[model samples]
Target: MKTYHAIQELEATGIVTAGITRRHGGVSRVPYASMNLAKHVGDDPNAVATNREIFFKQSRLTALHYCQQIHSTRVIDVDHTASATLKQHPEADALISAQTGVALGIFTADCVPIFILDVATPAIGIAHAGWRGTFAQIAVNTLTQMQTRFGTLPTNCEVHLGPSIQKCCYTVSPELLNQFTERFGSTIRKGTNLSLQTANTIQLTEMGLPVASISVSPFCTACRTDLFYSHRAEAGQTGRMLSYIQLTTKN
Candidate 1:
């Protein structure tokens, strides 16, 4: 079985590697069911470690820096010299880095795995955007951090919203729907179903990123349990897919 779904648009930039791991080809069982990359979940530690080993070996990525996600809008800036220490994962939902050979990753099941590549500055960012993070505008905050730290321009960025729970299955409460509607406008909600992808896209576009530069995945995690682990569809018991992007030492 395949180990991941590569983001071809980002990889085509020829200076980065981007992809999201799939739920197959590992040692996780039942709820996680193989290839689970997150440790915070209830999966066995050995299994999660083995799954990550399998993914790293297959992806040929040497280092991974991910945060302890809190569903907040916090963004972390990873310096080029960060690999020297064994620091605990920062409590954040987004990560931006300009370092080569280091991959930035985020875990998600139903939430969106947002990939940001500032092709001009050659920086990369990965954000985990659930309803809370989406409402908090985590994606835009990531770009803003890149702008401040790396002089990254919105027009030079190419973003990818990886596979996640879409509106077709992302039904929410009326109060929550009203909150999203008020912030992101009425178009972001379809009945009680909120479109987190649309909300993130709308925010990114408002940040001056070209509409054509953003690419959203068609795979809805909740709708495709065969290919992904969906927290909503699986009743909150599931694995997480790792969406990652790395800057390479090339043009």
Candidate 2:
């Protein structure tokens, strides 16, 4: 496997291996560039399949379970059987699984990919948090599902907020600003700039997760255009990046 150890610090937790991918190491051209993992975003299907194969091969993950994400807060628990049935599963924004070797993958092109792992349990989760899903509290919902389904407590879980469009470049309309203020009041932002990272961290804290257990990547997708694809920076014509996490079985 052509593994990248850029996130080795996160791996020290002994429960999860998480990292954000750069726009390299796959088969696609120009607009889709390279390393694009999503098939529904107008990229060539063959190239997407090839990209997925390469991604799993490099990460050493066997199979990836995907969600038909609809920017909602709904989260589902995936087992070996549920992993095989993802093609027909409901459109949800998050996935949690204690099933080993079943990689939970979520697609994004600027939106956040939040990965969670419980050190006390064999559980892992991945979430797609766009502005809509973030505002709807998908991260909280994912953590709640983990506690409800796997008996994992928030304090025992470690979180990694992967690369996404950061507040440095994620400007929003007045309508979105007003809606955020109306819903979360002062907790969502410091000013006109809506800090999605802060909002997610706050949600995790409210769930009893320690402040030190959460880590946010400093890279901004929109700002670091050379490394990541950004939908806002590319005017809605960008390829999606895949953030995935899975547990390896003891065999």
Candidate 3:
């Protein structure tokens, strides 16, 4: 397995640099196996740092930004001045950046990872969307932050939906599924497996972004244990993948 999962569509866009991490190519114990990018998942700090260094060197990003990620809609801005060595990242689900050479990273096991880049500006963003964050409209709120701060327009934004547990292996309880269906219209279900990407796409399109502006990944983390990590599939004991995006600070 490769060290990263990238958005091929945005790679050609020149200013946007983005990718996600996989389970292979790192130094860690079983369950984490190798190449786990998150520290909160019981992986050794030194091992996690080594794995991140591999990704940082490969990506050529100047700085990296991450959040505590409490399944909330909180958004923050990261630029050149951000303290790269800070141990405690802000508690936020989404991070937007207008600085060059800075990367925004979101860690996930099975939840959706969404990357958004402004086609016309040097602005980029990454969001971690679990069912709670999605239902709370984190994606929408992230867009709103970009629009307000960077003057970004959704019409000119390219969105990438990274690997997550799809409807095939993601199932919720009857009461939870009923609640989601009532709020977001009937979910496209396979015995209660929720289509998170679909729900997010609906909200994005409703916010004036063209349905075609989004590029979705076909890989399901739950189904692809050989490559990625799945919290649900592994019963909450697993490593995490890093979903990242950046604006090349190169002048």
Full-model lDDT for every candidate: 0.91, 0.80, 0.84
C-alpha root-mean-square deviation, each candidate: 1.4, 2.3, 1.7
* Over 4 Å off, model 2: 1-6, 80-88, 185-187
Kindly list the per-residue Cα lDDT of model 3 for residues 1-251, writing each as its tens digit. Answer: 36997789888788877888889988888889888989999989999989888877776665677889899999887754554742336799999888876678889988999998888865888899999988898899999999999899999999988999999888888887777777778754557678888888878888888888999999999999989999998989889998888777566
Task: Please report how far candidate 1 places residue 16 from its true position, in Å.
Answer: 1.0
Per-residue lDDT of model 2, residues 57-152, tens digit only: 777666677788899999878864555512435798898888876778888888999989887886888899988988889999999988889998
Provide TM-scores for the models: 0.97, 0.91, 0.94
Whole-model lDDT for model 2 versus the true structure? Answer: 0.80
- Model 2 TM-score (2 dp): 0.91
**lDDT for position 118 in model 3:** 86
Error of 3 at 208 (Å): 0.5
10 residues in a row with least lDDT, candidate 3: 79-88
State the local distance difference test value for candidate 3.
0.84
